[model samples]
Target chain A: MPFSVSKDEILETVHMFQMQNLDIRTITMGINIQDCRENDGKGTGKKIYEKIVRYARDLVKTGEEIEKEYGIPIINKRISLTPLSMVIDGLSCAEVIKTGKYLDKAAIEVGVNFLGGFSALVHKGFTRGDLALIEAIPETLAGTERVCSSVNLATSKAGINMDAIFMMGRIIKQTAELTGDRDGLGCAKLVVFCNAVEDNPFMAGAFHGPGEAESILNIGISGPGVVLNAVKNYPDSDLGELANIIKNTAFKITRTGELVGRVASRRLGVPFGIVDLSLAPTPAIGDSVADILESMGLERAGTHGSTAALAMLNDAVKKGGAMASSYVGGLSGAFIPVSEDAGMIKAVEDGALSIDKLEAMTCVCSVGLDMIAIPGNTAADTIAAIIADEAAIGMINRKTTAVRIIPAPGKKEGEWVEFGGLLGRAPVMKVNQYSAADFIKRKGRIPAPIHALNN
Target chain B: MEESKKLIITVLGHDRVGIIAGISNILARANVNILDISQTILQGFFTMVMVVDFSGSTVELAELKTLLGEKGRELELEISVHHEDIFKFMHRI
Candidate 1:
């Protein structure tokens, strides 16, 4: 037979998009804005705006073209720039907010959904710029429509920045209060990360690092529904067999991402960065990471044995994704955001998933305490304590973790706060009554773990 | 092997007469060359996969997709056209 694809293979790929929701989650263009810096903050802001509008003007159009040609839905076309703290270093807080406005205007003009990198890296200690950026985060996020901010407050080698964590807890609350009219929607776009990766294509934690090239295109592949269906197909198969099926499904999914990334790179004339093989879930019914866990014999996502199931699923995804793509980078594991995932939201509402259980689950998966809405009256110190816990996990385990918790102002526990769209809606979950004010106040550093001295 | 410009057109729906003729008519009008075709009734559903070279086609891929989509709607079938590269990348190394 003349080289031809088998019928099964063709149908299998088609069914993934037709019935199952298999789509590229994001096509992020990482642009280094270190060159946009100037002595005056206004000049820096103007240069950054012109540069982003010039560089990413065709990003959304190119994404749409690829989606049309390849029949794959490219959900969001976003741009990530070098961490803004470095660019805004030595600039005043007012200047930083003006830069954010310029960035926001550039994002809207370019037609991209979100522009990331209103960020600071103070994992070890705070620089003047990092402090200013952190202080301006609430105001910037509250004022801008599409500007996202992230702060890398901890790392395995750098340990946890307790002072920054405390500051972020206050900042998170301030952001919530600033955007209280929208139910703390500003916090939805702010992420506090531990061991944050530079090439991460997902928001609200995507930021182009200083180490990245001038311009690179990174692709994040999402196929939780496809994997969930695969797990459901082999109901009678054992766990090992089921894992193999998931790996194979992931291999195929990553291949699609690899193809799309290559095509986008070629068309955009930007170097292809990496395929982030993350199983990012959405608010859709079947597209859920929690559903995959439930299908794998768990009664619910947060009940007993959930951690073991998530660990295995996460490992299998990384293994298969690694084999499929040569240049695999970013947070390439399963993302379990509560509001964004319908199954996860249900688990929380049904009292099956708690913040404590979510913390345990994050140890095995990717990210931490994502899109969780807590009571408005919950202490800022409590939120800082949660970040400290997640940062400690990442520091000891040498994996990326982040906290994107929203303390919806005026919302009590068990009440619903709707952010709508991809940000999704979340029920305010209860937090611990105990305070960690004293502990949070004693701020310095947690010191890097023993493994940090590997040299 | 040189990269193939072939597109796989898969039509999946209830079985009906003149499905192939209708699709082939569109392809022939566009000067497209059909290389191979495979059809089977997969669990009471009519499934057909056709490999066609579109280099000689008169229309662009986007226009062809729209035309085939319109034809598919008329035939009450779900039709999809994909470049062979996607399959090669996924199934092969």
Candidate 2:
């Protein structure tokens, strides 16, 4: 054949873009900002702002160029930085909020959508800076439009930090209240994680870990629509055959990420990090991971056997994606954010999905309790208990899981809480009336698992 | 370097006259060299895929894409120009 790529292959690739919504979800530049630190917290904000603006100046332009040249849509260009606590060690709460403003300004200046890492890692316990950043999260997120915050409250090695979990419960409630008029939109920009990955390209959970290089570019690939179409094309395939089909589809999708990442890295002069194999969904129709599950013979995403289907899908995705890219990290599985995926929203509205069921689904997927809306009256203690439950799963399973639940202030169950755009909207779901106040108040670290002794 | 300047242009629409002629005219004007072209009609739909070397062109890829896009709208056809790397990366190891 004289053609390097056959006509069918070329048309198939084009059909994926035209009909299947395959896209590079994000090109996240992780910039280390330790050099911007100051002992007095005095010129730190200015230095940080200048540093980010300097490093990520051409990020959006580069993303647009790639999108144009490759004829593939790159939906987001974002930046993540070294966890804020380490950069602002011993800094006051005022300094934390100031640095957040600078991050937001830098992000706006660079024309990127979001800037992550107004964050802290307190898996075991909180330092002064960590506690300050956590305390300032509600105000920081409310004060700035594009700054995202996350707190790591647990890890398999360090076990669950119950105290941090309890504090995050209070913080989440406050964040919702802070942006209550917008249906607790602030909570949508905040995430609490267990076993948090260092190079996550997705937000509000993404933060450049201390272990990363000076600067790196990570890619997040999105193609639930592509996978759904692939699975739909093979209605009669057996489960094993279906898995193989999904793996092949994922291989093609991940190659897009690998190609884009390499090009963006070269253009930005940043080290190529990893291709996140997560099938992140959006509010757009036909782009739902839930839809992919539904196409796999499930009536709904949360119905029986949903977990098994999702487990296979997630495993197949990683297996195929790992082969296509040398570096595959982050929460590299299917994300089931209710508000973001129209299929998931419909499932929740139809009472096919519940918080408890979502928690269960989390065990087999990359992230946990994502973009869920609970009743405004849902107690802080209950929210903490939810975090504890998710953290326990991640700890035992040794996988990354996160909670980005919003308690839409003053909204009761069945009411809609709209965050609009990519954040999407969700119906306020009912939470347990029973209280976990006593358990939550007994705030101390949950000891590391027995498996921690292996190393 | 020549390989880097190669592009694959695809035109898809209902079968109509002057589809290739129109595209080739634009490429000829822009000095874009067509290396290979294979087109066919299936189920009354016309599909054309062309491999063009832009190494000899004075116009930028973005400019050519815009010109083709405007022409595509006028002809009621869907035209896309993508770097050759996109196809090779997705379909090859």
Candidate 3:
């Protein structure tokens, strides 16, 4: 038997593909090293490296087989692990920094583009290990080119930890000032989270959770363009049809996710976890979350029903992903990164989107206060204030959110910086313009929210 | 005689209404009992997995397939039936 689809339908799927006209974005291997620690940070990092390299040796070979089997490209094959800090708490900060370099080396050795889990989780209070991990980030990130770091400093149920925010503020400043001249882009490697998720296959922030068994594989699928094409033709389509379109589009996106992930795992010698079929918005003019809203008939993204619209989109994506993939994990939703989304930047430039409104939106998407481009003249305290607010959202929601604001040193509000290509261009967003020195200067823990006491 | 075997049937192709109902109806009419079935539709494509116990069938495998193939054409599906032994050998985890 044969299935016949029109040539136009085939072309539509092809056109809506990812960077390479491929639907499968990433396949991330989650390696569990509970059995590989040596208590010596350097030695442990070495063993960790060996384990990952050995486990992932077949990854590329397997990936090729799946690509042929499914006919969708799986672009990146990478590894994530339970936070190394959790496994090597006895090591000194310098040793931990050394560990990061080794992990980076391992990634390069095994042919993966990046390796994650140079991280710590201190959403409630800091442990010695967590503190060491946090302190090691600047040097670790600077020392390694292929390692990504993340710290979950807040969750939905816990309010933002002002202490962690203040520390991260100084850390960001230090990292930027240290690498400030070389694009000072060291800060790009780290993510600060509220309710940071475990199975996310995307990066600068994909860490294997401690709760996972020996190892598993997960995939993150992104095709904002695909979903856009679904509803773009229906400018006057009702919201119900729009949602159904999103749902159907998401189903296709996620099935590709499931097929690619399943094939990747079979090829790479690992069990499958979840396929995070998120319609990740990019800085491309046509693919932003705000653009999706505009296509849904909103004049711009920050309008009255924007949050409701996003919530609906998020729900539809989740439902479709759930149906298409057996294991759905990660911050699997439409991303609304301001700096990474062209439409969002335009909205911010037009004064339609604001830091306050972004915070409100993060309550429903993946990554918080993300890729926001703020004016350089903005005080460090204000930056910290922005982080604190985003962290507050994470602390209360138990979802992973992050702030990746680029204070492009000399750029002012409404100024534009062209990152070009995938990173995209960003409009210099306006900050409070006023000081939050008093609010941020009073550096103390913003204790957990009342909901955290639940059984 | 070949009907007295456990087989795995995979259905793949563009998703439209009646694919599931039509396929299952054919299997049931041939005295095949479905042990498990799962299906999903994505990007206009549909795939389904069905495990059937065919021990009580009197119809020939070729005849049943011919019937299913006629319906498969109407629904735009690709159907393949494989014995459990071949499936397990290829898919063992």
Measured by TM-score, how close is model 1 to the native structure?
Answer: 0.98
Over 4 Å off, model 1: B1-4
What TM value does chain A in model 1 reach?
0.99
Compose the digit string of candidate 1's lDDT tens values, residues A31-86: 99999988876789889999998898899999998787677888999999999999
DockQ score for model 3, please? 0.03
Q: What DockQ, on C-alphas, does every prediction get?
A: 0.66, 0.70, 0.03
i-RMS of candidate 1: 1.4
Could you tell me which residue pairs clash in candidate 2? none
Model 1 docking category: medium
Candidate 3: which stretches are off by over 4 Å?
A2-15, A18-22, A157-159, A283-285, A349-351, A416-421, B1-93
Order of candidate numbers by DockQ, starting with the best:
2, 1, 3
Q: Give the lowest summed-lDDT range of ten residues in model 2 chain A.
A: A38-47
lDDT of 2: 0.92
Q: Candidate 2: where are CA atoms >4 Å away?
A: A39-42, B1-3
lDDT per residue, candidate 1, B1-93, as tens digits? Answer: 244578889999999999999999999999999999999999999999998888898998899999999999999999998878888888999
**Correct interface contacts retained, every candidate:** 0.58, 0.67, 0.00
Pick the winner on lDDT between candidates 2 and 3. Answer: 2
Error of 3 at A384 (Å): 2.5
**lDDT for residue A187 in candidate 3, whole number 0-100:** 65
- Local error of candidate 3 at residue A386 (angstroms): 1.4
